[model samples]
Target: MSAPDQLLVVIDAVARRSDGESVRIAKDVLCAGAAVKLCLPDTPAEFAKALARRGSRRPVVIGDDRALVRAVGLLHRGRELSDGALSLVPVGPHGSVDLAGALGVPLGAVAAARAVLDGAARRLDLLVDDSDGVVVRGLRVPAGPSGLAVIEPGSVWDTCRSLVRTLVRPAPSVPTIRTHRLRVEADGRVLSDLDDPVEGVTVLSRGGVAEVVVRPRAAEPVRVEASAVTISGASFRYRADALVTGPVWTRTWTVRPAAWSLTLPAA
Candidate 1:
């Protein structure tokens, strides 16, 4: 007999693939019966509420990376990260689906849904930001790019083409080197103070606390261990996965390990 179905999907209409074609494609693949209850959420909060109500059901998000990040953030905040699986169908602006690629989700909506249905569930790490925002991986921001911002709206065809091109292109290097006087504390120890100027710092941890800074002169990812960390900076923004957030001056992040799971292909 086939395994019992235990998957639920919630979608954000404002995010990527909010059009008719993408939606139809997702509905055709992911929402085909009593196994999956596909919900079209008008807002992120509503989606979160629906997800919280569906205990034990795996979450399959059908939007861009930002939508996926939002779902992850909700789980982290709800303290239910270790319980279920989260999958994605990346349908958004170009470069917005980088996190999906990192998580091994296929580019096409139907293929991604299949991966969710047939892929193996694996434990994955999460990065909690200063504002209590949680991400599956590191954040990225490009400094010297023109005509790359997602603010300007484009046609569906144009957006689709751009998304394809971005996924195939080489990862661009960060050009502008901006520094921040950051105060980072891990566990109970101070890793860096306000006096030091650093380009960027990545706080890495599977569960407990591990941090590494990407400075101008650093040889490799320097290890700094702690149970929790706090970062404070001035007038600067950082990338969280594919989204850019905050000039948030001070925020505290606590390490939560094995906080989430994802379906992956066998290695």
Candidate 2:
């Protein structure tokens, strides 16, 4: 049998504690229709080990976005993502598993689990950073103050939470999407230089290239599609999905076109 027919379901511990009911539901649903091997990992180390030993079974991650990202990151780092063919069942606190939903994974515990059993494998794009970190979701450089300010806004309390997830320190007040000086280059073409203040930058995976948008402080949004992007300037942080990483002086990310595959609802 192929990996999808025989599954390895790795349930993240946080998801267990936060919402055991959802986790249990996911387990029951997945087990009902497939040959399942379930593993509940307490630490990240154990989780990585589970994935490493997944063998020929499709790995269905039962947790929030962070857990899902962790699994994808591990497979990417190990150079196994090209054939990983992962699935997800979002079971966590509210607003935490938004990435899965955004990716078209069912939010409900039962529906998500069922999808895992019946969904079709679809190729997805990814952003691989120079640091070797993989971004399964889109990248965002939220418009911050003059200094380094990063935002991870995806919920109702975006402004309040964005202030807290800053690179240096929280802005005193939610400044009206202030300017940040960043030198952005997409495919070697300069979209914005350090001399030109920018509101921020967003790079979303599109087919084979990333849709790069540089929000200039004074000019219209500069847009381009590139396989690689380089950003340099004063130290700044950025949100790569659930993680807020950086404060680095510079960074580069190249699109790994159709780098990985996911199990989404079958048409």
Candidate 3:
């Protein structure tokens, strides 16, 4: 398809802070001469509605990483991810837009918005889990005595405590780290057996395969590449993208090559 000249700007509620910077970014997009339809969605339902009504306009998400994930999930669910490319303007506190940075999106609102007007669409891979959860970046299965801590969003006290601990304490030692006995399978082959104690596991989709890295207690890390991976153990938690999930026995993720497209500055 040809490049989109009409755009749909969806601003998440959280990014509506900072003296209406999200709105100003939309205005900047409009001033650049693209036909823009701006929507300030305050809730998840509203966000869905706005996207559903996007018509032919290309979508530009104005918010943090979660907002981008929400839009991508909606598009993927609607089977429209391959139909058009999505753009993003990272609008939040300094460290909140890490995903955008990782995806090569300009950090500034104006630059990201302008990229929507004059950028190239690049197809990217995605990790689709068994439950249909999408992971854009990657995931980690922590190793330690406690394993991975469950961090719920909007818990101010928990956030403060964690922050304080990080600032005050020395780095955790290997013995203090929680370890789990996980069975990791990559494309049907077992990379790590359940009998082995693992320090951590990380998987990232690169090229057309999922790069699986298993860190064992006293051995060099094991790395493998496959299109699919399955992790099963007694009960473990994993951090997928920016969300933490599970205490479940098994979770499988398949790599979808070029599953989605994003607009990024031209090389």
Q: After superposition, which runs of candidate 3 have C-alpha atoms over 4 Å from their true positions? A: 1-3, 143-150, 153-175
TM-score of predicted structure 2:
0.87
Expressed as tens digits, the lDDT of each residue in 1-267 for candidate 3 is 234788888888888874376558556865576877789888999999999999988888888888888888888888888988999988876567788899999887777877878889999999999988888978888522222244556887988998999899887665465678999999999988989999889999889779999999889999999999999988887877656777789999999999999999998
Least accurate 10 contiguous residues by lDDT in model 1? 139-148
**lDDT per residue (tens digit) for residues 74-118 in model 2:** 999999998758999998877788789888999999889888898
Candidate 2: misplaced stretches above 4 Å?
Answer: 1-3, 142-177
> Mind sharing the TM-score for model 1?
0.73
Point out the worst 10-residue segment of candidate 3 by lDDT: 142-151
Clashes of each: 3, 0, 5
Q: List clashing residue pairs in candidate 2.
A: none
**lDDT of prediction 2:** 0.87
The lDDT for every candidate, in the order shown, is 0.67, 0.87, 0.83
Task: Name the best candidate (by lDDT).
Answer: 2
Q: Kindly give the stretch of ten consecutive residues in candidate 2 with the minimal lDDT sum.
A: 143-152
* Model 1 residue 7 lDDT score: 65
Using all chains and alpha carbons, the TM-scores for the candidates as numbered come to: 0.73, 0.87, 0.86
- Candidate 1, residues 56-156, lDDT tens digits: the string is 67787878877888888887788877776777777876676777887777888777777777777777777676667875676432122322354434567
lDDT of 2 at 103: 88
